[model samples]
Target: MKALDIRVMWFQRALHLWLLVWLLSALPAAEWLWEHPVSPELGDPGIVSGLLHGFGVWMPSGAAVPVAIALLLFAVIGAFKSRPWWIGALTWLFFCALTDRAWLANNGGTWLMRNALFWSIFLRVDPSKEHGPLSLVPIQVLRLQLLLAYAITGLQKLHGTTWTDGTALGIIASDPTYGPSLLPVTPGLCWAVLLFQLTFPLAVWWGPTRIVWLAAGVVFHLGTAFWLGIVDMAFAFLVFYLLWFPEEGVAWMMRSLRITSTANTT
Candidate 1:
């Protein structure tokens, strides 16, 4: 297999593993989020629900947990299966159904995961054939999605007073729901974040600056996970970061893993 194909294959497996972890973590709250109580109308049912409804296949309240479980199982299969094409499709559909049913419980991370799963449907995971030109299309779409997300968010932040005045991070630090009250926030830190987001789309495409920006992204997401209490969101973005990894980076990782495995056996 070519380097790009290898990278794509690894990325798919890693993404599936991350999705499995996420689903496992959410299992405890399945009853609350999917089974009963709470505001379900807070989120729109979206196109998936509409399509299901059109087909006269409305998801019953009792079906939500089962669907969620199925998705988790499919994710596990996808992680290990070499040819997970149809499995990936089913996973995405089940995910969309669950998310649509319990939209109120979801956040940006959930939507990002949904989008990633959608693209995963098109990813060529077959190990035998060399993925031709079409395989790169879905990968490019994933890359564009991340770039667009950051670029648009940064632009929107520029229009907002809080981000422009460097009060955004300070405010986030004080928020009880998402942030730790005792966490220190600085204006310079706020602007630095803004700068990174705005420049990431452009910088990440350049070879020299790609590694630098990706390294910064690691710090950024890790800080969000630890300080802001947004572990899912942080992991979601970090998972997508795998797509930006150079081919050499993937080769190096394989070598390191082989060495570690050898050492473990000895």
Candidate 2:
């Protein structure tokens, strides 16, 4: 297989794994997210939600746990066999249904996952290369989506005093809800985050700076996971990073796992 194919395969596998983990984590919160006071309602927030509402597919509040369990099962099946593109489509539809119903619970991470799942519907994994070649358009779309997210976030931060004055991290660290007491937030660290977000879109495309930027992103997300207690959100963003990973990097990962050698020997 070519490097591009390898990267795409691994990207699909990693994305499937992330979805499985995400659904598993959300199992316990199923009732809270879909059955409580903030449960599903018939509303046309977007085309998809409108269609769902039209079809009377808005999941009933009482079915939240069962629906969540079904989605988890679909995720498990997708993780085992990524070629079933319908799995991705079904998952994305269900995700849209849940989020649209409980729009109050929607966040940046939720939207990101929605977009990723939408893109995944068009992707297929065929190691045998017997189904012809895969289109690169969806892959490119995911990459652009990720880059735009960072670029826009960084630009928006510039409009705020916290990020500009380098007090954003400090403020977040002091927040009672999301902050950790041990975080050593500083002005320089705040500025560094701003700069990294603004520069990532440009630097990550260049071979020389790609790895450096990717490593910085891993550290940035991991830090947010540990310090801000946003583990799911952090991992959600980190999963998109696989789309930007270089072919060589993917190969290195396969080698580390003995996958490449095992396949070669077979």
Candidate 3:
């Protein structure tokens, strides 16, 4: 048997858990399937109808919740061990279709989730096995996706007055809807956020700077969660950070653990 890349295995496990959390969080929304089906007028009437209208064997609303829950359960199991890669991917694809059928609730985050889930399956399905070279492709794609998100968000801030004026964080914080209002939102903090986002992609690729930024990223997301009350989104982004963590660091960690175990056994 080939020696598995322990680093990739752990990364895959993180993704599995990330998917589980998002899927479980969506469970409450299943009621939507019964309450409102997709509109026939949106998208193509035939395609939309085709999604909902089906033989007794299958239909969007009829199967959406059940499939989602199954996928969620599978993710939970996959988090602990290997799962059938094709089935897991197909389930996520179907889930995306169901969400599209309920297009009103779809947002950029949902699209990102769909993309992430699709790419995640291409990683190691069997946690026990070492990852093959092909698995790296999906991980790289995931890394690119997250970096693009950060870069785009930061670049967009350049277009807006509040972000540039140093009033953006303060404005959002002051609002009852989104904030840790009592916490200070200084201009310096705002500038730091801007610069961090703009350069994160580049900075993270280098060995020495990667860990510092990765740690900072965790703190950044925690702050965002506090300010925006978007705990799920923040957590999701943080999970993606695992993709950028250095393989050498992981290998060193594993080696340390092995050494400690050997010492204990002596």
Q: What is each predicted model's overall lDDT from 0 to 1?
A: 0.76, 0.74, 0.68
lDDT of 3: 0.68
lDDT of 3 by residue, 1-266 (tens): 11134544565676668768766766676676423454342444465345433312245446666666676777787688766778666656665656665666655556676677777677663433444567668867887998999999999999888888899988888887875586788998889999999999899888788888888899998987776777666877876776676756655676776622111100
Worst 10 residues of 2 by lDDT: 257-266
Cα displacement (Å) at residue 106, model 3: 4.6
Candidate 3 or 2, higher lDDT: 2
Every model: Cα RMSD to truth: 5.0, 3.8, 5.3
Evaluate model 1: give its TM-score: 0.87
Clashing pairs in 3: 4-130
Would you give me the overall lDDT of model 1? 0.76
lDDT by residue for model 2 over 1-266, one digit each (tens)? 54555556666766667777877776677667665735556555576557443224555546655666767787777666655777777777777666665666667887888888888888765556533334566878888888999999999999889998888887888889986568677899989999999999999878779889999999999998898878877888888887777657766777776664223210
Q: Rank the candidates by TM-score, best first.
A: 1, 2, 3
Shift of residue 161 alpha carbon in model 2, Å:
1.8
Model 1 spans > 4 angstroms off: 41-48, 52-60, 126-130, 257-266
Q: What order do candidates take by lDDT, descending? A: 1, 2, 3
- Per-residue lDDT, model 3, residue 163, is 83
lDDT of 1 by residue, 1-266 (tens): 44555556777887788889988987898877667735444334466566432212465657777777887888787778654578887787778766665677778888898899889889884445655678778988987888888898899999889888879988887778876665568888889999999999999877779999999999999998898778888888888888888656766676776522111100
